[model samples]
Target: MNESLHGGVGKAQIKLRTQDFPIKEFVCQHDPLYIRALFLQAKTEFLLLSLDLTSLTESMVYDLKASVYEEFNIPIENIWITVTHTFSAPHLDKSYPIFIKKVKEAVQLSVSRALERVTKLAISTDSVTTSLNCSRNIETPFGWWLGRNDLEYSNHDIRILKIYEIKTDHLLCVLFNGDLPPSVMADSYLEQGGKAVSSDLIGYTCRKLEETVTQTAIFILGAAGDQRPLEKSCEDIVSEECLKRNDLHEAGFKLVETQGDRLYEEICSSLVKPNPIFLPIKAISIYEKKVFLEEKVMPIPTKELKPTKHFDFSKTGRQQELTIAGVSLGSIVLLGIQPEVNSLFGEKLRELVNVQTVFIASMVNGAIKYLPEEKDFERVTYTAMNTQLGRGSSKQFLEEVRRFLKESNLSVDKQIN
Candidate 1:
């Protein structure tokens, strides 16, 4: 059950631009934003919906989950909703009501279509490396700013989960995971008076893959709180003659195409390699827990042109809770963590799990600011300053994940015996 609809188009009445950058209007539409869903009904039913938006609010998540449960008998815990984190799309607030209604309708339609075309599933996992993303925390004298920094850590692994039709060998869905957003590469267009609302790199990559194969491509964002795409420098932009009439837009589109093409080629190369050993279908085990994050009043720097006063910072409130959810799919485990997560936490979780495959889907339930590692707070990085969770909170969340995996594995073993 794969279908896509126009999320929205045209300039939004209200714009919540990324990094506080302003845009007068959305000049063009590169491609239609899609709400893609893939439903799997095995021993336990599961539904995964992917969107081309930046983020969804907690209330929206609750409403969507309730609606899905009422329409289909799927449990709230079994429904996993995620966003691609593309910055070019309109603010969910402005697109709300209508946008969310369309999404709900799409989900219902997908589920109905899925029931009609049920097929045996074969799943496999594969990953490849690409130079698409880099760390965005620059170390400055004031503090760690949110800018492109070559020294900071970045995650480059593009993990892919492929589901296929058992008899026809046709690909059903391809879930690709990475820690970079499509807007990273095309941000320059916004600076150059480009007003096009595009899905950017993620959309390009998905489109290219769909063109190559007859399958629905779903993108799942990883720990990308401190990550961004490797953008073209000013020199590179000048070399491309972007100053000439609307050439900036053309250059931006070209950049997206080149990056998307490279990613598609990498995925194709990995797919052609020896197929991964498929894991057996087992009873799906779902675990969910909410950890209360200690709230703290962080000082925000003043926006004055010059510091005339002694006190240049003001206090503000941060997030107060973190929701973690996990679903066991045989050898593969899907962990969904609310809010933006740093890559280091995801890396640590993978090390602790020591599993064949672990999908850490970040910004799952809602957006609650950044969740940086404990050590990162010492640097007072942008993520650290913006985070609601205090130091060692990441460790606590990791422990919860570890426990869930261990208990789930034991449960599976006992059932087998």
Candidate 2:
């Protein structure tokens, strides 16, 4: 007989209210930051930890894994750590080492609280189609640039996972998959010594969910390498050169806040569903497939690059190779990729995986950079131009994920447990 599934959820604030370091002393405070953890217990255990900050570091990651392993015998591979990928927060620079130290302590406490409260928890899956996000890749007279392009490919579908107590039937926590970076204020004028540490969309919206809903909400980045908030912080981004350099994108705090409010309202539609369909998670397991792609993507001349409207995805969509990893909670499979992926690729991979239900998250494990679609290589979109990965990289990534899912028997590697 399989071991019964049990889960616990815990969250602790980073107490950013009085923090002085904000990368360049440009940001001060908007709301308190937090680190949340969800512990899944079974024959094999997994700790899913999410941070509100911008990203993670090697020392911070390894140290937390070591600490968790010391406290609980779960292996390092089973401890999954992902960030909200908020762009307006502090950057990983000279002051990161100190800030990360505090993050480590709070994260450890949250994990401990979760582990201590292991109880029977059931999961229900639902999704909401939203227009809060749009494709950021646009065709410039100069070439592909970073601008709002609603006509192009954009992922409006957001996957939601609700964890509820099996005994009381009360919702315990919510895990929502964010398709884009929480970067609405990414290029804002906050750089002009604005004393405010904003969480942008992901942080702002999720924090609201926790406060109003009164349940822990953990955010996981989905295929959002090319997606951006429909309401961008600044306006009139003219040149591709300026966009790439992060030079001219200006600030509009009101725009980002409005976007957050819109996203929060839309997500609530899915959250407050009259009834939810829970997955049969009798057993839990994790799987991963690694591909060694060393060939660097050579750059195409900007003048020769094509625009977004020129390429037809139906005819041009192709597959190639990439590193794919995932975990199975019974029938529902949660897959992850390390690089930032475009919205179309995310949808394509989900369709090909052949699973009854699957959620593909990007920037998982760690963030390598952007992985634009195959045709983007020919067109040299902003992503295609900036990514160090070579042509057909995204296609290859899809092909590998397809293979991984098939071999894993619906994309889940069955092992000890």
Candidate 3:
């Protein structure tokens, strides 16, 4: 396939999320968050924005989409905005109007710069298997807990999308999707009594990769509902009994550095590999479908779940209406999902779908909670309880995705693996 790929890649650094707070509240010492944009044009336009933040609300995404559309004349569906799911960065709250403004400005600037330098592109795809994360669903005396289950499943394969400037064959941007959450320092605190706002895993690694290659790199969070970093700074990642201060709060940055180093090395080694396609994309079709999910109700007596965060399910509505969105770039489809989908169900999706590759942005647009498979409900795992969707929600969502894929002409009567 041969075609010209237009658009460019750009990034803008973000100030500390807690910069306006008191001295004790300041979190970042070294690493800074960023908003990166990748705008491409084939048959369908694509403007993908990757944020080094935790999450984005549905309403916020809508407004951001509108702003990008106003600036770039791109449709809302063609704009894919996603987060790194970095726990180190503080969530956006009502009081952070200044930071919000900064974010909005950064988005506009990044996209504007990208549009100014629009260039033809060539693309290639590759993947590297990793064990950086393990399933965080463990069975204990008290039901399934949010802990390391080393023997359990995780999306070990990191998908790579390398985009290059066709004229010079210079790497312009690289998008890598991994299953690990950038939360290695999620619970780490400073010795002087403050939390740090480092980029954690994905952001740190991406920064390193960009510096090494002298190009843009974006981190897309993959299906990681049941996955967690094997190297966490907290003591109780395995269990509450895992003790107090498993890692020195101040030295937790070292763990993050190590995690980032491991990830960076893996990707750098595979930056250019054997037999890459480097094909010019033929076309792109952005598609989405609405799915209404019922809130889960336990049928039997179970231990009360202590979730880390509780989203206002009621605010969303009586039934959760999530979208199964995708950007089909010829044979490849980039899935943009709001919730953290279980790795197994994500695999099921790959098996059922007929696309050459399906790289799922696990937590995009919004964070509803984890969506585990129907069989996983029996495990009574933390994901099962933490999630708002009822049993079989994952299955229902898979069906909806399949239907949408067929409707969009992105799938055929074929199976993958």
TM-score per candidate, chains pooled? 0.80, 0.85, 0.90
Q: Rate the local accuracy (lDDT) of all candidates.
A: 0.66, 0.72, 0.76
Q: Model 1 scores what on Cα lDDT? A: 0.66
User: Candidate 2 or 3, higher lDDT?
Assistant: 3
Best by lDDT: 3
Residues 266-324 of candidate 1: C-alpha lDDT, one tens digit per residue: 77777776655666765566777776655555455422211112221222345476777
Q: Write the per-residue lDDT of candidate 3 for residues 1-417, one digit (tens) a residue.
A: 244667799999875444465423454555788899998888778889988888888888888899988977888878888888887766766576777777888899888878888888878888887778898776654456666779987879888888878787788888898788888887667777777777788888888888878478998888887888887777553444532236578777788888789888888777757555766467777887788877765432334444322222222235788977878776778878888887777777776567667787876766678776755666656676666787767767777777777887777564333
The segments of candidate 3 whose C-alpha lies over 4 angstroms from its true place after superposition are: 17-19, 22-29, 237-247, 297-317, 412-417
Q: Which regions of candidate 1 are displaced past 4 Å?
A: 1-28, 94-96, 185-194, 232-250, 274-276, 298-319, 407-417
Q: Which 10-residue span in candidate 1 carries the lowest summed lDDT?
A: 3-12
What TM-score does candidate 1 reach? 0.80
- Pairs that collide in candidate 2 are 28-195, 28-196, 188-251, 189-251, 297-390, 319-395, 320-395, 320-396, 321-396, 321-397
Report the lDDT tens digits of candidate 2 across residue range 216-302: 888888888888888766644666454343433334666666777887887788778876777676767887778744345334454
Judge candidate 3 at residue 347 and give its lDDT.
78
